[model samples]
Target: MASLPPSDEATLTHVQSVLQTRTLSSPIYAFILTPLRITHASRGLIIARLVLAAPHLNASGSLHGGVSATLVDWAGGCAISTWDLRTGTGVSVDINISYLGGAKLGEEIEIEGRADKVGGSLAFTSVGIWKVEDGGRGSAVAVGRHTKFVRGSASKKVEDAVKTAE
Candidate 1:
């Protein structure tokens, strides 16, 4: 196989879009894709920022672990999911999380995550959920770590074609 091409989320979305419409027959995606947009995207790293209202807040008037888990899953997945665009396959194997402070309700929480390391068939990612003020220092309320299973062959077809044309 040739060297692998660099990857990104737009790249993955584009690649997955067709398959999503065809093979990915999930009705749940309709709701997840609408209203809540994927604010940030990139290869290697990704961050998703969400503004919480009443419904998203927890019973004790704080962010919920389930919500936090959603952030962990998405961020971590994005951290490594870009691989499928370049090599074409993978999934999450294990995910771990630690709660720090209680994220207050009504505060906008931003979930940020990046690949800590990438080895042969595994990707280690770290995620952080924080309360960020418009122009002030933010508080990290939760953190998560994930191990993603990676697969498939590396190829430089796209980059190679572009390079050859250039």
Candidate 2:
């Protein structure tokens, strides 16, 4: 397995711990997708880093399209979470991704997400997946945009109704 650098060890450990617990609540994220470290986080922006692994590869041995899409979606959520918007409760209304290149296994990649706009009922976010280079000026592998609808009282009522029905 590819290992993080000494400087990133602590971050890796924390990411593992969070994934382990999140696995109980969100199995797909922990088991199927590779774990990632949040390198930077602030209001409206979040940056994540990961080393591509076997599970993230396609038949051609490059990063899979689906995996890239998932990362973009997750990154957007992370960006929104940085701002603590909508209590971090929102549903993706639409997501579009454009794949430009691919990263090989064991290669490190950076995912940067930015919340472009956050409205009362809607939020718009963009994400860029980059293949990290020597100078850390990585080339873009993919770019994506996501639109989310902030959960409101109507969403709560729907959840309540579902629970009552169940």
Candidate 3:
């Protein structure tokens, strides 16, 4: 497992607290994805864990495709936010996903988001949804790449988190 340096972790924590208080925050996350716990965060990465439940199932009782895509979108933004503590990560330009497996109710799965590149006008991110089997071996449930247009999205208040952490 990768870990963030203390300063970066402090920044992440500060940003997360601000995000949680906003009434206009992620509706999908507030509705169905609450209790989602971030296990680790680094400069360009985020790792989280959640248990599959009634709200996250498909007709066949496996993790829903839409849910998987939502995770990709949400996690991708989170990874981007870690890049420079941007509060508004950006708007999605494209999202591509490959379904590799399925997870059932009561199962715990991990979602990992990585910011491949963050540039002046665009940001690229990849996310992997993994289900762990016995002995702690993880297999991919889905993988996705996300591209977002991020020009002029940085906010001074959010950037202050980094300065305060430092």
Candidate 4:
């Protein structure tokens, strides 16, 4: 029920509308075949929803490890963006994921990302993917840790200065 910045809200609305209209032609998201919806957004926390489907499953009919990894990566980045840190340019420097359990197709999963620490030039984040039960509680399926190198504030300042001089 939290809110995001105006700019981020616009971005979120666009992404949601794209998925809702089934007009998302991006290869990666299309291949996953899951509609990701932002449920919560704040300074250091973000929550999203993903309903698994055939394409997200493996031969054994559970969620694929690679797909989980990708979710972690994407969710972590989304969470970090909520902070609006340093002109909002951050790139993943390192990521680690652990598969804890299996999520069957048709299950609704909750993906949460938290910013553990945000420094001037680097940021640390953690992500968890969980299977949501009837009561809305979730069981952990995967957990991830991520590190990002942020580079935008200084560059933006320089660019602004140059533009002003012109």
What RMSD does each model have against the real structure?
7.6, 7.8, 3.6, 5.9
Which pairs clash in model 2? none
lDDT of 2 by residue, 49-75 (tens): 888999989999998998898888777
Which has the greatest TM-score?
A: 3
Query: Stretches of candidate 4 above 4 Å error?
Result: 1-26, 85-89, 153-166
The Cα local distance difference test for each model comes to 0.59, 0.70, 0.79, 0.69
**How accurate locally is residue 85 in candidate 1, as Cα lDDT from 0 to 100?**
37
Best by lDDT: 3
Candidate 3: tens digits of C-alpha lDDT, residues 55-117: 899999999999999889888988888887777777899999999999999998898888999
TM-score of each candidate?
A: 0.65, 0.75, 0.85, 0.74
Q: What's the C-alpha lDDT at position 6 in model 1?
A: 46
Query: What's model 4's overall lDDT?
Result: 0.69
Give the per-residue lDDT digits (tens) of candidate 4, residues 1-166: 2444333554454334434433255567666635677776666667778889888998999999988887776666556655542224267799999998999989988888777877778888999888999847478899999888865652233235447779
Candidate 1 per-residue lDDT, tens place, 1-166, comes to 1233344556546334422442344343332322243445556555556666655667898877776776686666555644333433236788888888776755666676677776677778888887767743287789998887764442222354447779
